[model samples]
Target: MKMDGETEQLHVVLFPFMAHGHMIPTLDMARLFAARGVKTTLITTPLNAPTFTTAIQKGKNTSRPPLINIQVFRFPAQEAGLPQGCENLEQALGPGVMDQFFKASAMLKEQLEQFLDKTRPDCLMAGMIFTWATDSASKFNIPRLVFHGTCYFSLCVGEILRLHQPYKNVSSDQEPVNTFLLPSLPHQIHMTRLQLSEELWSNKETDYKKRSSKVKESELESFGVIVNSFYELEPDYADFFKKDLGRRAWHIGPVSLYNRSNQEKAQRGKTSSIDQHECLKWLNSKKPDSVIYICFGSTIHLIPSQIHQVLMALEATGQEFIWVVRNEDDLGGFEQKMTGKGLIIRGWAPQMLILEHEAIGAFVTHCGWNSTLEGIAAGLPMVTWPMFAEQFYNEKLVTDILKIGIPVGAKKWTTVPSIEDVIKQNAIEKALREIMEGDAAEERRCRSKEFKNMAWKALEEGGSSYSDLSALIHELRGLSTKNHN
Candidate 1:
């Protein structure tokens, strides 16, 4: 099915959500497409362009470079009434600001259409948050696929719940209902009332619900979805999505495992904000499977009280650890006390590298899909402490379904009397000890190791994910040929 001459040049536009969690995986996906000889145009605001520039530039230096064009559009910050340079979700933390973030995202519609007209790409690969991109692709008759930066298990449960509306029959929406089984799913999946995202409770008129509606509509009508998961990782869920949903999807991930053109083998282990050698030196000193690594991803900044509880819990475990604190202010004086026993990585940490370290045994994570997958890839069990969004559901996939994660008893964040229900130090301490020293740790560790191998195999030549990606590339090339003719 190889196209001749000009038809081989399949141009694709990747429009990811502004957040790092969403955008980073999409960039990796763009690289995958580029590696397969697809011309990729990454669309983002000027402020977010730098994040992908290094990776894009690296591809060009390779012998077989994929045509990766970076397109920068001005973020409608002022027009959306957001502060200057606040182009991403991580920056807009204040109440009612996410509304403005979506508003700014919508503002990109006209500019995106103008670019679509100029570039006339064969396909548009959009992030789940950018619902408007689906329609923009339709105007030009371009094939569009929404990229979901999560596993198939989460997606299957989410879609099943959305379609069946099982929660609608619950007696009280405000109070946490007992855990109940989802009849639609084949797995013994049970969800507590509170496990649903806080946004689900919002009225339909709210920005969150309105955006959700748009995403659902796009999911139903678009070409398909490109998920950051591999078929072997969740075979049942992946099969369900393909067979039941009746939508085309390609599971071409653990995309993090893909070699970045800029990150040479020697430089792959480096953290963004820390010196690589110095961090590696400390890790080298520790014994195998003796250290616990803790991080809560990029967006969810822990409050001072939550930070204190976590610090105390790590100390209670009495094991060597590395903790990533976003803001130094959150730790205050705690870093001074834990000097020899614990290492505090202020700002960014080399998460994937740390997880891969021989010294690292377990992870206490927020259950963000990227972090979860990274931990799995490293063959490490987890202490799940989900903060918000689909994280709670992800927590279930790890703790209950996979049986490789210990929960800290955090059901959901309560805001009635100021963000209450923070998991106390005792629960955190129990979870830490279970994963770091308890008997169950061995069982969890073995399960994690199995998935780690599967993740790697999926990316190798002739694997499920690799073949799926090739199929997707061929389909896009066909589209390009048809359009040219």
Candidate 2:
């Protein structure tokens, strides 16, 4: 339905949690809304203010400039119980981090009161961590929209499906919950006990039975939720989010689609971000679509044990690849560990550029939300190597539901883990080779292109995402203009 309003002018606020993954995408969304003439106030901690600004700098469409104003609100540290300079949600490291997040929420309420007192934003869109938003929004008589910085499939598993319900705080030493059922999800999408953790399951300090139980309550109550995916990508999941959850869901991604397009135009035929590897040149040197791209995302830590296993697997397989690894210090024992016919870049790679390169055939990813979307947007197939909490869920959607990626659900962060599913090294190599060079590769390419087109249409004028955003702007204007009489 079209939103009934005089003009689509809105005085909106954007508040994302202070992390690269969370803040960057929210900033892009803010830019999109601002471009559409929404008066956008983006709220962030001091640390992230610069991060968002840098992203805007990259969006180089000066002719059609960003159409919104960004406002920053700072919450006190000790009061919010966060150590000063906490850039991203530390609580994300493990379940032990939840208490800190809870404390941060209490702190935000105090700081937010001062913020609202000075400037009344029409409505608030917050990162999901600030679960106390309903209380604050109600106090100010404004709607609060919580943005889940992940795939809808992951959120559904987190929200409606309760996929982790059965293993509430079970001992890890015991057999894990591999291949569990979800309430609303298709059987093709399955999860294992390896993904479940005690922190997500148990509320150690609170009276609540589990941490996820509290998470569930919050999921039920938000005024609206925004996910960085489109309906065409996962129609069944999208439908489940709306019809079953009784809430509004807008699939406005892959967000990188709009961002990559904007940045490519801005850079104007120049290389951007990290240095371009000869990997592209090398891949071009080989036959069509012959290289594998492997990356574990920004926040993952690689201890020596983990590195050794990967080295052995590659050395045994004898396949060529391109790998990106970011670590705290220099390769501690790396020379002895990885002896394979492959190139390893020690830091960040110009991911958008590399993915767009024709030589790159398959992505071996951690399945972090951003990486997953980028892989899709660039039309590359994936070899899923999920690392943390919701990534297992995301892996299932990509490999199982979407059928564009392969799920290699090995949770062993290192090759030397005592317990593993024991898929042979040859099997792993064969899988990689098959996906990159065989009929499987072609099928994946077709599906990847299919979703990419859907994402493009959703962002263009008159598409579902475009219409949803316009409606949001229209509603915001009505709220901004009308007195609540």
Candidate 3:
């Protein structure tokens, strides 16, 4: 396949951040580009490569000429003072080796620059974390598009908070219950001071603040932003991101929709611990919209005491549920106690497949963008329990703007939450009851289903996301022609 005026096919390079949530969507984006007849190359390290191999092979088997290519780079783990196989954030987070992880990631800059100088692709699409990628692409005269791995609503909210500084007027930064209204957003979203990162409140020039400043600076200098969402999901925020923020951006997602078959859905990011057939059989036994699907995503893990609270909540509600836990040992006979009522997936579960199942009713999510979009795609109302990062912003999108989720009252932004801050069994049970029963629950479900239908429509021919993708390809082709000439 060739462009209208060009003899060569347009080639684009994708570099995703080494996190499960980021990598999954980037792979989907690669396939989306490949399906449109564009040549795509995905750049990852050795440890992370295995996670993507199956998906790449599946893409090759289906697509003609196998447009998707995988390029592996050596992760400088040892050089950066990290353990030998620590290539991803999940691994690094567990040992509190984040500084080393960032150092290792920074070490990839020279290699990436050399690769771009050699290949000189038409465009470079990279994760937002790779702040150096902007200058690297600029060095090769290639347009760089930053992928935030999130939706426009969260981005808009973040930007509004940054510029307006609404939290500055709040009484005290230490007060977990102090609520502040986010100024100048489309919605009147209120957030607690505790839900925000400490860096936002402090005047200290820490490493995180410095890195964030660079990321924002790079975004300003980059060609455009790529969002993993559909316009219909948040029309106001989508428009606000472009018109008000004045940034060149594209929404060619619910990229998860690219997985057209059960096989693809079942094996999306990481290989599932449980068999797809068995998982499906369990879901089939339950009635429609009866089970609450619970997962906190790949990064966050609840402590044993917190896990116990969740288990007690599940038992108290007597709700049929599927909970994905980091370790089965944390369950400690609770799994046996809830035997028929709960399905405890020890490691990775086929999230998309389970979410798409008819019996899966409500979602208890961390409000990670990937999980948020997946829940939206599956038409399931959520119980949002944001842990860290921009998740609180996403929770606002769900509970405030979209009104398809009920917040589980998780106030503090923490990576390793203590028992003191654990969202209690009562709060979890309350959120479950609210989302799974009553008139309000039905309304939320209806709204969620509407977004789900819109998500599907956005991927169909001539739809919003579809047209945006086509337009992006066309724009890239034009740039490619100009670059060659």
Which candidate number has the best TM-score? Answer: 3
Question: What are the per-residue Cα lDDT tens digits for candidate 2 across 34-111?
Answer: 777666777776655666566556554455567555566664555655566554653245444545655665577667
RMSD of each: 2.6, 4.6, 1.7
Candidate 3's C-alpha runs over 4 A off are 5-8, 63-65, 94-96, 173-177
Clashing pairs in 2: 95-199, 177-192, 177-193, 178-192, 178-193, 306-414
The clash numbers for all candidates, in the given order, read: 0, 6, 0
The CA lDDT at 135 in model 1 is 87
Put the candidates in TM-score order, highest first.
3, 1, 2
Model 2 superposed RMSD (Cα): 4.6
Residue-pair clash count for candidate 3: 0
- Write model 1 residue lDDT over 1-485, tens digit each, in one string: 44445533678889999988988787778878877777888898988887788655655666766667889988999899999999988888677887888888889999999999888988999888878788889999999999878888888877877777676666664544655677667678777667775566444566667777788889878999998888877788888888987768898988887753324222332226777677888999999999999898887767677777887887776878998877554676777888878888877776777888899999989889988988888889999988677787788789877888999887764322134766788999888888977577888898999998988988889989999998888788877667777
TM-score against native, each model: 0.93, 0.83, 0.97
lDDT of 3 at 327: 65
Task: Report the CA-based lDDT of candidate 3 relative to the real structure.
Answer: 0.90
When 2 and 3 are scored with TM-score, the better candidate is 3
TM-score for candidate 2, please give it. Answer: 0.83
